[model samples]
Target: MVFIRWFLGKCILLINALTLPKPMLRIKADQDKVDKKTQFFTLYQFEACPFCVKVRRFIRKNSLKIDLKDAKNNMANKSELVNNGGKHKVPCLKIEKLNEKTMWLYESDAIIAFLAKETELS
Candidate 1:
């Protein structure tokens, strides 16, 4: 009975860890490069969402310039980004570009790769 209880307890702990939201690193911009080529990769994500965390990690670690849109609690941004994206999904990216629109790009990995190429610091 003791062993069974211990095993069950461990399993429960594992499940909790797996279900918990992943943490993300939020960084502040240091320069005034806002009005350049693109208006930074506008990202809509939550601090605990894993997929969102990954994208943020890439941006933070590389110190890439980006406009973060927190959609978990910010209902206005949530509706705009998610509804605009047509899936109400977190971690949605908004690439502001002239000759193109938001449909110009979508997807986390793709956005990450684009930043990596541009920054060349990744």
Candidate 2:
């Protein structure tokens, strides 16, 4: 059963790699705006997680420059997720505003939606 699960996981990863999406076109001015807006955002994720993959693909496709934190292997990142985000969940976005306000956003779909909205304004 373990072997079967591992094999299926590998297959899923293979498919995800083979069908990777293309990044969106980045205009210099728009990219600059995106950079300023997302400078305080960081993403916490596990490499092999499907939801993390989805968020990563969205980030790549939109050319967002958000930093990625690996919670699977990094003990500090794991603790940060638990302590700051209030949960140890992949695909959680840490957004810090200019006023020092912070937000912990979870769920892949919502993260993608938030990025889309922010980028559209850029």
Candidate 3:
């Protein structure tokens, strides 16, 4: 079962890489603003997770420049996700707004929605 899952995960990753989506075009100034805003956001994910891939596709399509943390392999990232995020889950988003408490958001759909609304990329 583990081997099967790993194989499927690799296949999914390969397909995703092969059929990359085109990013939305934005003027340099506007894209720079978006990039600056995304500086406080970090996405914690397993590379091969389908949901993570979905969110990644959205980020790529929208041209968002959020940072990615490998929660599956990186011990520190995994610990942060499990401790601060309060769960062991992929596609988790760490939101750190200025003058506001940090938030850990889960679910690929919710993450995508929040990013779309925040970046105004949808």
Candidate 4:
């Protein structure tokens, strides 16, 4: 019984490692679409998520001024993201619109591209 349980646990771990879920990407806001006067974009992410890392690096490299939220810790922010984006994924971009509404965006590639184009850092 013990061996069987251990084997099952190992299998679960292996599956999680091998089949890591892909990030979600929705809503692409262009540079011209966003206002430059906005203080900073907000990012919701975890420490271990690679997708989050990519966005952070790009924002840092380009010297973007944005707020950071740790999804693993903050329930309010996390719930807001999940409610708005419909998924609890890291590396989500929150763009503040001219109307004072927050926009949620996912996917590493698209986020990087949008930030690059918006900040003229690409």
Highest lDDT scorer: 3
TM-score of 3: 0.96
lDDT of 3 by residue, 71-109 (tens): 999999999999999999989999999999999999999
Q: Can you give the lDDT of residue 15 in candidate 1?
A: 58
Q: What is every candidate's alpha-carbon RMSD to the true fold?
A: 8.6, 1.7, 1.4, 9.9
Sort by TM-score, best first: 3, 2, 4, 1
Candidate 2 matches the true fold with a TM-score of 0.90
Clashes per candidate, residues 3 or more apart or on different chains: 0, 0, 0, 0
For model 4, the superposed segments whose C-alpha errors exceed 4 Å read 1-40
lDDT, model 1, position 87: 71
- Alpha-carbon TM-score of each model against the true structure: 0.61, 0.90, 0.96, 0.63
lDDT of 1 at 4: 80
Q: Clashing pairs in model 4?
A: none
- Model 2 error, position 82 (Å): 0.4
lDDT of each: 0.64, 0.89, 0.95, 0.69
Task: Give me the overall lDDT of model 3.
Answer: 0.95
Q: Can you list the residue pairs that collide in candidate 3?
A: none
lDDT of 4 by residue, 14-119 (tens): 6555755553232345333332533667888875466776676666555556788888778998898898877998788888867676778889898887776666
- Which predicted model would earn the best TM-score? 3
